[model samples]
Target: TNIKKKMKPIKQTCFDKAILRHRSVIETVFDELKNLCQIEHTRHRSSANFVVNLLGGLVAYCLMPSKPKIPVAGTYL
Candidate 1:
């Protein structure tokens, strides 16, 4: 089902809630990668540099102490 700004009460089901939660988590990850990890850049000298920057940002993100995670089956890691 399509997500809407004005969601109707009857249309708010368990599946919809789960989908919305997952989307939010994905957005949060991208935001962190761009803002915290410094992945958003436009001054790359070459494709290799761009790849290196992206990899470095991802590695930095992996080393972060706290990360946004979606729970699986009501369990979090």
Candidate 2:
């Protein structure tokens, strides 16, 4: 079957592991913007209001302090 041909039991590379670890941060940012900021619900009567809100959100994101990245435990030799 074509599905069987595509199924290879290859080992996951380091890059794959890195992405799996870091992807959650990006998803959280999107969730926050949509839920907390009401960015998706913005409906302005004028162009100025639209621009101001969009720019304001972007500025807030840049100024926001990031959560500290916890250090991964090291294996002993």
Candidate 3:
């Protein structure tokens, strides 16, 4: 939502609820990646180490039993 005026009878802009919901889900996933998976770190001694750490974190996330995901409407043949 956007407010166009600060005075009386303020005008407000409309926003899509679906887009906002999707954005919130994306943020939640990133938060989990950075915090729970420890994907964001500054202790890498070399580029290779950083890459390895990133890959490891991704794999760990994939292996987790429960994770946030977007639902698809239909199956594709």
Candidate 4:
């Protein structure tokens, strides 16, 4: 099958687990944003309301002191 053929090689290596581990942080951030900011709900009755809600949630997230962060190492690339 196509799926088996495509996944066969990837499953043979550890790279897939590494990639998933890297993405887990991003996934957790999105999960937090959705739950804490209530952005996942589509209850807006109007286009303007939807846009405002979306922007407001994002701005609030950015202004929060507990926002998720990735630590930086030595120097900038």
Candidate 5:
């Protein structure tokens, strides 16, 4: 209750809405890396190699940009 009292409410803006909307992409990426990519399931010969690979994969994901959505053209009758 005290924690809630100290917290201030943030005003919702376009940027906030944009961040909330795109938050799922990060969640999806994490889900893919954990479950789909099987990055955690490893059989490595060397600890150093494993760490390097893991870091490299994460860096690649961070460096890669999200795919741009294509806009659909409207037809006028």
Candidate 6:
């Protein structure tokens, strides 16, 4: 694909791996927020309740002990 060809140069660098790993972590967090945190629920009776529910999910996510983190690879040393 054209996009792949354009990205070929960057893919040759070691930083590309780190960047991809970081992006994967972000994607995983969004997925978990949408599914596990019930952030996509639309049955709320009022807009105020909806905002409260959304904030609660984000707060709960922030307080979680186990969360996504980038690995500390030896290459960074």
Task: Highest lDDT: give the candidate number.
Answer: 1
Candidate 4 local lDDT, residue 77: 28
Q: Mind giving the per-residue lDDT tens digits that candidate 3 earns over 1-77?
A: 33347746653334455555468777988998999889996988899999999999999889989887766465322
**Cα error of candidate 1 at position 76, Å:** 0.7
lDDT of 2 at 17: 71
lDDT of 2 at 59: 74
Q: Rate the local accuracy (lDDT) of all candidates.
A: 0.88, 0.65, 0.77, 0.70, 0.63, 0.77
For model 6 the TM-score comes to 0.57
Give lDDT tens digits, candidate 4, residues 1-77. Answer: 12364465533346665545557666778887798877877777899999999898898788877765544374432
Candidate 2: tens digits of C-alpha lDDT, residues 1-77: 12256698667788777656757765777776666555675569999998888777777666767632423565322
Candidate 4 Cα outliers beyond 4 Å, as residue runs: 1-21, 72-77
Residue 71, candidate 3: C-alpha displacement in angstroms: 3.2
TM-score of each: 0.70, 0.47, 0.63, 0.60, 0.41, 0.57
Model 6, 1-77: lDDT tens digits are: 12364464443466665566578777999998998777886898999999999999999888887887766764421
Lowest summed lDDT over 10 consecutive residues: which window, candidate 6? 1-10
What is the Cα-based lDDT of residue 33 in candidate 2? Answer: 68
- Pitting candidate 1 against candidate 4, the one with the higher lDDT is 1
Better structure of 3 and 4 per lDDT? 3
Q: Please tell me which predicted candidate would have the highest TM-score against the true structure.
A: 1
Candidate 2 global lDDT: 0.65
Q: What shift in Å separates residue 11 of candidate 1 from its native position after superposition?
A: 16
Model 5 Cα lDDT, one tens digit per residue, 1-77: 11256689667788677666656665677776665444675789999989987887777656666632323254322
Q: Rank all candidate structures by their lDDT, best first, as comma-separated numbers.
A: 1, 3, 6, 4, 2, 5
